[model samples]
Target: MFFDRKELTNDQLVTFYRQILLPRMIEEKMLVLLRQGKISKWFSGIGQEAIAVGAALAMQEDEWLLPLHRNLGVFTSRKMPLHKLFLQWQGHPEGYSKGRERSFHFGSKAHHICGMISHLGPQLAIADGIALAHLLAGEEKASLVFTGEGGTSEGDFHEALNVAAVWNLPVIFVIENNGYGLSTPVEEQYRCSQLVDRAKGYGMEGVRIDGNNLLTVYDTIRGVREYCVREKKPYLIECMTFRMRGHEEASGTKYVPAQLFETWGRKDPVVLFENWLMSQAILDADGVERERQRIRATIEEELQLAGAAGPADFTFQDEIADVYAPASEITGEIPGSDRELRFIDAIKEALDEALQTHENLILMGQDIGAYGGAFKITDGLADKYGVARVRNTPLCESAILGAALGLSLEGYKAMVEMQFADFVSVGFNQIVNNLAKLHYRWGQSADVVVRLPTGAGVGAGPFHSQSNEAWFTHVPGLKVVYPSSPQDAKGLLLAAFADPNPVLFFEHKALYRSITGIVPDTAYQIPIGKARQVHQGNDISIITYGAGVHWALEFATAHMEIGLDIVDLRTLQPLDYDAIRQSVMRTGKVIVLHEDTLTGGFGGEIAAWIGEHCFEYLDAPVTRCAALDTPVPFNTTLETQFLPKARLREAIQRLVSY
Candidate 1:
């Protein structure tokens, strides 16, 4: 419990004792409440309190912090209301909704707390990207990312660390090594005795500190953070702390060895600091009591406010309102689009027009510059706009998404591309957890567009041929748009670029060259969350989107006897419920199709929506045609069979006969 380190000042030690104890007591109370069933679940940062508070105190106001789930000390110190934290545990919508975020994922634009992410390790990569943004903006600030020892094992940790190291980014990577990762000890998880060594692999100096010693924790972080800011070089610090409680309140402590807890108990961070304070004669009995009383009062007041603040009133209707751009409210018809152009050209023209219109917009991705793009959509952009605006990034998907988020925060409209939609999984967390939730967390809007080449037909297999819209559609903050034809692609890309929040724009490779349609050269934007009726018939409502829309229309048109009403849902997130409901009401029959697997696909969501909202309109059970639940095979014949195609014709024939 005692510390041999002498780097910490007397004042810093006393401050740590005062700040950490209050949060620790509050955490203890919540843990009890969780056991009593009054609180839903609790993820307490108990034994690791000293390091958290110390590090948070060392951080500057402008520096960004991307916190993980176990960030009580960090949040509390940063003025997060404890009541809101409690409300979050109680599952009240207002809990996370009180701030820009809807849960324990607290952050503030004013505070420069980028936000907290529940995912294990991707936040580290985000921190790296934010740091990159700060350096590029020529700001005198850095970014700090805090994670546990287990998080170091994730691929994101490696990617972010390397990027930061290579670029000499203004970032500090702090590893809270609390011995066990959900009951698995450090010995089982890693081969090295110290986690700091892991940072060495990334070409950064890594330091090991006695985390339980408040003075050591504070001094180490404060020193390294300053070094990063001045030197613009990332550093890693391993905080050797321990967990006094279970991972979450729902997880029983029976799995953890009592002996391990006993071993760590001797080095209890709070007790160590209190004893050290007394030993240093920094404070007498009255001083310690006053500090405790002050913290307790602050926590009690916040908790009272949080308990009375009721749940969020926002509903699914709120989801429909914000899918498009905030500044440009171009709603009527597609602008200057009476004539037609190629989809690829439409995409290029849209980008060119958007860049000229908005000075904040930037295009970034691998080979998107002079090469135009992997698909030649961004060709001639670099020459016209300059290389700085149309950036060619390293072949790292996570970094690309992270960089996009950083740029978006700084009022830049960033359009990042994944060479293929299947490759988007590489940056999935940054897209889903961070970029999607930016507006939700800090209430700060991030205008980011992720353009991805999706679907199959050109001999690309599982890795290259994927319609991953379903993955993003399920996420709360993102808006997914899959355009069927070239015109729609142009309109949708422009709309996505203009959107205030994050947009995952999916472009089908099959339609890139094969299915040509007309698009105007002038500025144009397609309305998001609106489905166009491609064909109007009385028999059935075949709702589809993206490349699948073509198949749905072909099958419907081929069968003259069974007329169909085909609705193309251009935007997946803010689904065109009005169009869908109208079609279902008129036809009284429904069929949903997509290029993804049927299980947990977007079609299931559409079917469920129709079942809930238009059950009476149904003539028979709603049928869904989706790709089989297997990887896209390399063989052309197998790929054809795997996708949702003319099989819908057979379904329509059977339905008409019935």
Candidate 2:
């Protein structure tokens, strides 16, 4: 697809071709660097450089841009130093701190880039939030987010777009259709003929363009950017591009159809753009040769400088750098308010309080406005905070999360919500790759909070019932908190918003209304990464979180004959390993429990850690009680059978007998 020629000039077209070729060479050099053991992994936007550079150039400094992993060219064209990028791949902290070397998967704040998260779809939704924040703050900034065609299939994509369109968010969504998600081709990804066509379902504008043609990509992005800013509507632009290399440095996808690869290579966007530039008389033979020579020298100098830079200070003291919020200085007394509200209501209070306390705080989610959010966590927020601060986003989770990362760099504290925690899988790429590692990779902070209504008891079934704490606990730089009571929920939620690093805050659906406690009236802050001892017993310790905490306590009370101490792990990340060891030391026995499947649940990590650290104190093997490895059955009886319960009367009895 081509844009009408009246839009772009010959000079602009020539520059686009030159920029595309520059990054292509960089990609090839990085590939060689990886093969020679100089770098760990190389992600080159060799074939798709036009789209990245075009969209990036279209964005103004104040406006936001969230690019995907393969968009390093975007950062470079925007003035990111190549040496810094190389240093990042070489595991040098200074490399990322100085330049935009951190865009491999996670983004860098130094360059006004958003936190690069591995989760795919959430960035779209976050873009909605950024647009809303600018509008609400009465600022003249627009927001743009980039993703792949494969990410468009995620439910979060639909959710983000639906919300953004309904609310008329000033956001642009760019789909870089490189044709493959890892090894799965776009044909195998979705039945839809075009990724942009799905925008009709959300009542938004959608267009497909030649991603490799910088003129087309730039014109399309500039139009959408202006529309989002002026009309306050979202746009979906699909840039049909290609990837000329393997999925990752480690991947050798032998399954891709040979014919398809050859066809894509022949229509390479970089070559096509160059050919177009020559046809347009923007460059002669000598000019093209000179431009190529300059790019080569730049690359060589960048590599030399990067190689000269030594390794990072891997000392243990450096580990504490980004662990906690720097401004977490305890203010005297945070008086509690006397509002006896529902769990979701407390969430609203916390969000408002955060926005009031921190100027950077921006909120975005699905149906979160006059619609009051999917669960009303943001009821009346759009009206009160204005459409900018209280943004209702499109259904694209990856984009939402990615945009939040970008918005965060502009010094905005962002809180993006997923309709359900189960749907977080859609944005898993943003979470694992970007949010969790951005601070570490880029040597910058990402103060972002993502709240999801999680857990199974509500009968939401397999799609909505997933308790995904285990999926995130393994990721570094992310703190996972699941509160069982409204009081704990409010306190932990506030704490998460106050954190410097990204956090996953899950409010169990079953506890939102069914449970209530004496929560403080106002913003009562709680420290993260600290476990609360709910009960004391000399016999054994039951370690759990979320819904399981309540059940474990109930089981302990019901079987009072067996003295069981319950440890509520309010924060799953940066786990209180010392507290666990101390509890084990006192009781000489421990049992790990969770609601997720037994195979790869958080319990496995806990059990292994305990086995390694407190093996001598254990009176028995570290036992874990969890749900069976099966999708949450729709039948109540089957769910009950499959779910984890504290009928620990038997386990307790067995432990005592042993």
Tell me how far the alpha carbon of residue 545 in candidate 1 is from the true structure, in angstroms, after superposition: 2.9
- Candidate 1 per-residue lDDT, tens place, 561-650, comes to 777988998889878899999999989888898888889889999999999989988888889888899988899999988888847767
Report the alpha-carbon TM-score of model 2 versus the true structure: 0.76
The prediction achieving the highest lDDT against the true structure is: 1
The top-ranked prediction according to TM-score is: 1
Question: What is the lDDT of every predicted structure here?
Answer: 0.78, 0.77
Error of 1 at 638 (Å): 4.2
For candidate 1, the TM-score is: 0.85
Task: Tell me the spans in candidate 1 whose CA falls farther than 4 Å from its real position.
Answer: 1-16, 28-38, 81-104, 249-266, 297-329, 337-339, 383-389, 394-396, 406-412, 430-446, 536-542, 551-565, 584-593, 597-631, 637-658
TM-score for each predicted model, relative to the true structure: 0.85, 0.76
Output the lDDT of residue 624, model 1. 87
Which run of 10 residues does model 1 get worst, by summed lDDT? 318-327
